[model samples]
Target chain A: MSWSKAMPANPVVAVAGATGAVGQEFMQVLHDLDFPASEIRALASARSAGKKIEFAGCGQVPAGELIVQEMTPESFKGVDIALFSCGAGISKEMREAVVAAGAVMIDNSSAFRMDEDVPLVVPEVNPDDVSWHSGVIANPNCSTIQMVVALKPLYDIAPIKRVVVSTYQAASGGGAPAMEELYSQTKDFLNGEELKVEVFQHRIAFNCIPHIDVFMDDDSTKEEWKMVVETKKIMGDESIAVAATCVRVPVLRCHAESVNVEFSGEVSVEAAREAYETAEGITVMDDCSSNTYPMPGLLAGTNDTFVGRLRKDPTVEHGLALWVVADQIRKGAALNAVQIAQLLLP
Target chain B: MSWSKAMPANPVVAVAGATGAVGQEFMQVLHDLDFPASEIRALASARSAGKKIEFAGCGQVPAGELIVQEMTPESFKGVDIALFSCGAGISKEMREAVVAAGAVMIDNSSAFRMDEDVPLVVPEVNPDDVSWHSGVIANPNCSTIQMVVALKPLYDIAPIKRVVVSTYQAASGGGAPAMEELYSQTKDFLNGEELKVEVFQHRIAFNCIPHIDVFMDDDSTKEEWKMVVETKKIMGDESIAVAATCVRVPVLRCHAESVNVEFSGEVSVEAAREAYETAEGITVMDDCSSNTYPMPGLLAGTNDTFVGRLRKDPTVEHGLALWVVADQIRKGAALNAVQIAQLLLP
Candidate 1:
């Protein structure tokens, strides 16, 4: 029943939905991280089968092509680690098959994220949570993953009391099709052509959409709900209060957040800056005078979470605000999942 | 000294910086509102002199064209209301001249906004503040103007203790040149050509720049500072605390705000919606199921402040959160100034 028993030196990594955006990132991250994988399988829906995914391999991993195969229960028969980003429903349906095949599911979907038994892991924030996983480790939501990664070091300096985050998320968070939609619509906007709004509810090119995901009964979008709940679970601090407003912008790849964190004790801007500087997987780009701050356009393909705009929120007693950005597909989903798999290595 | 004494059936109006974006909006708004102007003078820098500005007349105001004149102190000699959108320095230099010419200067520049002697007005929020003006009434910052208009209605329901606002501001808030830069840069971005970041400090096409204006010693941008100070001044409440993160998006005209307001007393979402519904110069657009929310793409050129995404913020004792959008050039600048001019009329 434990994940530890199935750990392997050269794990058989299977990427479900390999033809999709986050799925492709899973392959790229595995190659970039030089993860020790004896075999890598690219599994997708029947429609995408026979497609080829290029792996720009690193270290011992050979640079080669992975032909997409149909995803079925038999796909996980020999896999040690199964990375799932197909969808929540697919993840739920395939959970038992992957577990029955003795493979740990590092899910990018929201299916098992809130499950008490399945540990939601952000490697930098809570790698130890991976140790308790019963064959499944959930990757935190993209926005929550980046925010928590930036806040972890600060939280260590002084316990976080509350967090107010407003996200400037990119179209990539909606998947490759959404990114393409943004591109086509923007071109249409420039060409004096009528825009198509199939993927998104409204025109997203040259505009900001405040609604992301379905609206909950309380009026907060489900994306906002994920940030609130996932942060508490991942940080293992239920007492910490979180309020989020998730808005989708026209950027292609990275997600940027304006976070206001109020601490239990006074944490100076100097101390917070130092903590971020020393934190793993965080690049501090906060020199105000030089105009050195993270923009999504610049941080599109970057793995590290860029932190900037560090200042005091004068409204609260011990409040510090920061701006955080990261490539949503990489560190927010695929890379974090790979890191969790790394944590499970024997 | 009362503005009541200068009330005329047909007053002479002069628009300083008439060649600029906001100044053009000044003419459009004046015509649209059909202000009883006996004469309309288009005044700009000497380089723009002799250019013709056509007025699409409204109601009783006849359609005609005015020849752009070189802005000089003498230009305001016979003017009753001088609308100024010239830069801060010009506003400061021309303040005395406009007043000496026996005219009320409804200044759009930040030069006199924070001055204790000058009234910073949003008309809907602080129209009476204009009464104490010594021949000059300052327009609030664009981002601040929309936010205060949305908050004023909610604030009347219960005193606001603190406000956390994150703005998705358009390029027009930066002026006409900034909007042009967005257009050109977006075209460049689409064409795979080098993007020119001249008007703004960074590439604003398909990107969100956290740095709006020059950064201060505390690392907050000048635009953020304006929102804080101007909100306090316009609301006429020094006790209310405000924290703002102003980001420039790729949108052309309207500025949107995600506001989290904490009140001293209980305020339900229904009550807040009702407050915005009954409030003047405000429109509520909060039907989540129908996906009817005010977005900048649909709100450009609108005069009324749009409020939507109404929900209760559970983080505080009595907190409510909402989304606000308004045409940055119209209600945020020219329309607000014209409204102030309307207040001066009998």
Candidate 2:
């Protein structure tokens, strides 16, 4: 079921859900990466149709405004790559049409992530997973994408046995409206007005919510479950056990994770640092003397997955602990999707 | 040597570092708990000597302003219990004077915590640890205090083999000035002004700092080290291993922890919930169906250690995960100290 036709030298790319947060990031990342797109079309729901979105041009596309189009089956007629950031329902609704139109959909939704024929890919970790994709290439969860980017180098060093992670996620992971809620709620909180929480389960201003996404039947949030199952799928290691507690903090953009990894054999802090230093798409920001580490507030628009606070965990026989941070919208979402699109090039 | 004389029914209480954050909380908690203090002396350094602090009526002490006194060696002459929240250096300096004058020093600093003679006590977890204290009984670190409270009830159900905890600590844990910094910096950040970070190493307005205290030689922060050592000492189980990554979050008060505990035996989520329901000084707030879990923003000023998000971690055998939150100043500091004082009563 792999792609039968070779992708053109310059693909006609469609940015689905263009008016949304990650959709905008998708356009920016394509320009930043200098992706060779012959024509770029902005597609969204009927409500957002005709909205003008400014685009910094990339490849053959001119630098100007892109008029939003209502996404429909005919929208993908000449599209070589459809970058989907719409919800899962919309993605599932348009999947067959997208495939039949001879366009490869790199989906940001969770719809086909666990499907047997669909490829769940993090370009830095599993770019080869893109080769076998049957029309739809699933982008891993934002949290899982950054984690696996940081974990791949380590996994190459030694087989990881288990991971215990607790995330300090950002509002950006919830999309544009959630970020707006954080901004307005913060203003209200500071002004002594009662905070109105509409986008989150509770007021996200100056607070930490232990729940992210919907709660699963097993009491783990859907986001937490995604990290567990996605890591196994993307890393191509079913034996690795992950216990995740995903929490949302008030930070507007970058998501940080405190990860403790236990390997099948000894992997020293020095070895891990060296692995990260040479690893693709990973920047090491660990230095205790200078008070330097990757902070979420200051790392909003970065592409690399930043790793820091590397130390040994004496509690386990073969363990190392580290802190990871990356822009949830950039490396965690948009940049990773763009990288996957890069792998689809001829 | 343990206290030689029996404590009077109404002890003369001294609030050292009276002008500091935890010192103020100590006073509030004393009144809140209706502690039987015959006379409450507000003691501070020479700079704050003449300042007055308002005290609510409690026991023999009347509701009025108590003039602060300069803390000299003679300050503990008639004091029966000296609740010290001053820095570790000052606590060490005043330890001998308070103990020589026959007053038990219940210190909130890290001064004598690891000292063999000083018994680190969390009253609910190990009230008996106070029995053999040689003059000074140490209150555990704020992060360690809440975690052990949550762990105690679970441990009672089964022996915990290991614990991996990541803390979302509040600005209040840094003292009064830190809370002030969070308030001002957040305002400054919202107003588009450069954040002034004085109390913390970096901007903590909407960021998470992985380093809490000074970094140890092994690269783990001192705050993380305290959680590891203090938990073993307070739990009276040197066999229990702990790995902690402590981070400072933007919340004004109340520290929240994501704890993953692996027990030596099977402990179901139902069994763990039952243990927490009957556990003293703990409140279980877990209900995924109703979106009910303990949140740091809504749970300020609470004395109980709030436990929620209870679930099974299939990653390991006999594993259970939970989220714990407590007012860092109350149960983590002042209230816990007062509870220890209650243990010292005749």
Candidate 3:
């Protein structure tokens, strides 16, 4: 069936792993965007199956509640669109069942992202890639998603030669438990009590940990590996060289990145600023004299990618350096997934 | 009088601006390093003159209490060494007095760092640069000091062609008031009160601000400009290109840097690690598999410059990326001054 053809007036949506941090955001985003769905189902593991989540609906959608159900192969029987935020292992196990049930699965996990048939889509950067997906569409990593969104406009002006990114990632990227860990550990530190390290490998209260995810044989963290590969896939440019240093900071929500981009041709700062001002889903917050730049603390819970500190890089022949920030759960994962679901609507 | 001449067993020392943050650290460093001084005088602004500071002296020095004196030209009457951390204006006004009094002024302010006659010294990286000092020696910027110390060993292996650095600086780099502001603002944030941002341009309790120092004409902050020029002067290499993004995080002490270095010749990870391990003031804490990396929280109050997360940068032909952390108060400022004072002894 062609997604472009009108099949139903309103689609039936299923939110897998609905109790998760990103899963909860998925529900909020769908409501905020006023997605026309006749029915919405919240599915999770058996542990959270009976938990109730209230949705303060927006516009025409009436306020309602959902009782989470234990997901099974038969759960997607009449679902037209499924948004999955479970771990990669669960996504791998449940993807085939969702596809067989005739639902277009937009997976936030990395299980099928690198698969030859799967299309990794960032709506603002590569929306066209969504059209070629066979059964599943994948979301890029949170860090890569924001960087690509900010870089897309500039890359369109002049082809990018290479990128060097250093990330100041927040705790929310690891999920709700990680945010709780940061809060508790900080409280303990303030009270002169011993800090317990459970979610992260080290004490993250006022410290910067260079390790994120697990380490690869070559010493690069898996998070850094995802940025290098996912950036190439989402930007649809295999030849663009990328180097990443992903650091975890003691922040709660928004993830910040210092991105240095080198172009094959000359791209002036004025041209770059104009390109960002006209780009979709981007907010330019630069003005060094007035000290108006993006910080994770101020921009948390916002949907737009905030870009600031734009300047010329004197090291390269033609280069520009910028700071980018966005709420990792919203624009990076949930909103992008919902945008893809809106595209698949009849 | 030559500093090399052993005319006296103990030299008269003076601590300028002895009540501020770096000034307090100056006293601690002098005591901890056991600088042999016949007498110690604490000097500060007129408001802080009467305060008493206790020093827990080390080695041959005996513990004693010093009464802070209102600083004047006569404060350096018989002082063989003066550690100045007052602002640039004070340093500029007092330099002639200290020099005429036959005292070498180790100035910590930015007043004389770029002056051609004054040698900008990081003892481990450029000890030879100290030989030609004309009565005044300048300390490099805190952020620049740590990066160069970490890069010095690797640069010696093969000269670094270009450096791209992004810093996670601590609040202590701003001064004692900034540190107090961070603590008070954080307490207010946790208690659901309004955050008062006075010391920094933005809220730095749980955020990162890219603007440090003043903005230059080309939109780069003076802190970033300092890193570029100071790295060249400290390393004695004008051909090396540098780009930096100096950010202030909520950390209380040590500064962390994510540095990517490109070299002119081939350098392997093992070779780079060996150079750091063999360097005078560097500690290699890189064992990614076991999560043994240097973090600012764990390494505060230490003199060594910690280096970790060492790996190859696949974006450059001959390159390496590493993380460096150093106590901004100790090695970054006070300790470097004390080390230079030791070099002046007979």
Candidate 4:
């Protein structure tokens, strides 16, 4: 049940797509957990090989390049856990290969999220579901992960029939290219030059982009679709009716969502506040009397999903409105994957 | 029935409380509108006297001291048009006095908005309401003014029933001292120094403050109250049920709102789009295909209320979600007041 090379017994960890943003974050998180690892392998496409990354603030020897070695049954040798953070295509191609090689795969992609056997884990919301993963565990989308982390506790108190959320997502969720585009577009606009947008479909400087991913036949993007489906899976209710309008803001790191949840019965504001206060992995910063609520700048570099602006929705009989913010790179991707690895650690 | 004497001759214009943020904006805007003024009287409290301000854009005239004069009946003697940008107390103190002095007072404070006598005007939404003002025109609250401007066109095409809005208000809505506090607190947070909060009840640096103004018995703040009442007054419809959550974000100038509106009849998203396209004082920017949407930064320094993220609220039968952004200092306060003055000009 372990990937220990020597009988002395220390875990061997493998980081798939280790050079990407969240992938790099996963490495740092693992070292921060002081994961009892005898060895660590930073794997990526051959294109990113020999790229050295320094793991500061966490235990690290110099990071080695991931060779262009094809992921196969033999690739998971001596590895107890494989944290997959590359794109969905790579995860889909190699998920079974790594798992068949006898290592547990904690994937930070959307490939196997709907797979009934592959548990979609947000740890705080559904750690018990992790036991059901066939071989690979799926990480929920960044927006979905933060929201359900806050919504789960509330949903348990009263059955949530509907959720309407509008997300002010960050550039990090679009990967390093959109991050570079944000920086470049901002610099261009600041310099009085025309903004050039490549990664984004439009100019992202000083503007909110409503389209996060390509639209489907229903006009909902893939990102919004993830929120709708993933919430159903994580909350263990397919009838949970969720609708989302995903937007990308100029913010650099944290993603924010303005969420309104309607329940089956009357959920008073005070009761909801207390529920969030006691909720794990969720921080209730709701203090409107003194003007303190959750925001992206405040949630940056934090693992806890900050939830605030909690108030009763006067529109519906049993409705609550809140603003939730979390670091997409951390809790949404890296830290969640690392948590799964820690859970599976011998 | 014009206020300008130029036609007419020359209109004597006075800017009450002409030293504050919107007051200064009043003077600039008066000149920008080519206000037919033989004399411009700059009035403020005794505290802000002997301050010479040159209205360069207003024909490069050498400005005199900001007179330390009480807003009494006699002081408003020759003012054919008196634009009042003073506090609510000042408006209450001088409204009758200015009326007796034979000057039409356009007060930009909350003292007279709900009053049946004073007609609240957004011009874009209810310009005709201005004709009935009994020597004292009421200016709607900043947030309310912008919301109604965007909602007016939509309401005409489809009768609106309920409006649920959560505002991402700017620091400028609270005036200059609050802006100073925002900068100071931000620097303090960055320097790891003690955060100083004076105007706002809480530290607004890297945070969202949900409470604006005093709280009402209903647990909503005075701000939320003003939006509800003023929208009714300006739109001339008390039947529209409205609820608002006013939030102050760290943003300096523009205020953004996430609005969910429902109508009595089924209105297609395309119909709402058409209504916005033809609406005056509004710029429709709802192209979600290319990531184009309205944002506070782009709306700043402009008078138009920019709206985007136009989509059918999948949860409701005739509901649509919209994001509205406008420069609070300009369209929400200064420019709006100035535009009202423009209507009175020759």
What tens-digit string does per-residue lDDT give for candidate 3 at A1-346?
2234232557788899899999999989988898888888899999998899998664345788888999999999988889999999999999889988878889999898888889999889898887887778998889999999998999898898889999999999889999999888877888789999999999988888998888998999989999999988988899888899999998888899999999999899999999988899999999866789999988877899999999999899999999999999998889989988877765
In the range B150-241, model 1's lDDT, one tens digit per residue, is 99988898998999988999999889999999999999988999988889888999899998878988889999999889888888898889
User: Where does model 4 exceed 4 Å of error?
Assistant: A1-11, A34-38, A51-75, A115-117, A175-211, A215-221, A250-252, A342-346, B1-10, B35-39, B54-74, B176-208, B214-219, B250-252, B342-346
Q: Compared with the true structure, what per-residue lDDT tens digits does model 2 show for residues A1-346?
A: 7779789989999999999999999999999999999999999999999999999999999889999999999999999999999999999999999999999999999999999899999988988989898899999999999999988898898999999999999999899999999989989999999889899999899999999999998999999999999999999999999999999999999999999999998899999998988899999999999999999999988999999998999999999999999999998888999999999999
Off by over 4 Å in 1: A58-61, B1-5, B58-61
Highest DockQ model number: 2
Clashing pairs in 3: none
TM (chain A) per model = 0.98, 0.99, 0.97, 0.92
Top candidate (TM-score): 2
For residue A7, model 1's alpha carbon misses the true position, in angstroms, by 1.0
Best by lDDT: 2
Can you tell me the CAPRI class of model 4?
Answer: acceptable
Task: Kindly report the docking quality category of candidate 2.
Answer: high
The positional error of residue B249 in candidate 1, measured at the CA in angstroms, is 0.8
Candidate 3 residue-wise lDDT at A282: 96
**Per-residue lDDT of A1-346 in model 4, one digit per residue for the tens?**
3233222236667788777888778877866676666677777777766676665333333344333343445668877778888888988888767767667788888888988778888888888887666678898999999999988888878999988787778889888888888767755654578887788777765555567777765556789889999999988898887768786766677888878888998788888878878888888886655556777855778889998877777767788878898998999899888787666643
Clashing pairs in 4: B5-B8, B5-B9, B6-B9
Candidates' TM-scores? 0.98, 0.99, 0.98, 0.85
- Residue-pair clashes per prediction, in order, are 0, 0, 0, 3
DockQ of each: 0.85, 0.90, 0.84, 0.26
Task: Show the lowest summed lDDT stretch of 10 residues, model 1 chain A.
Answer: A1-10
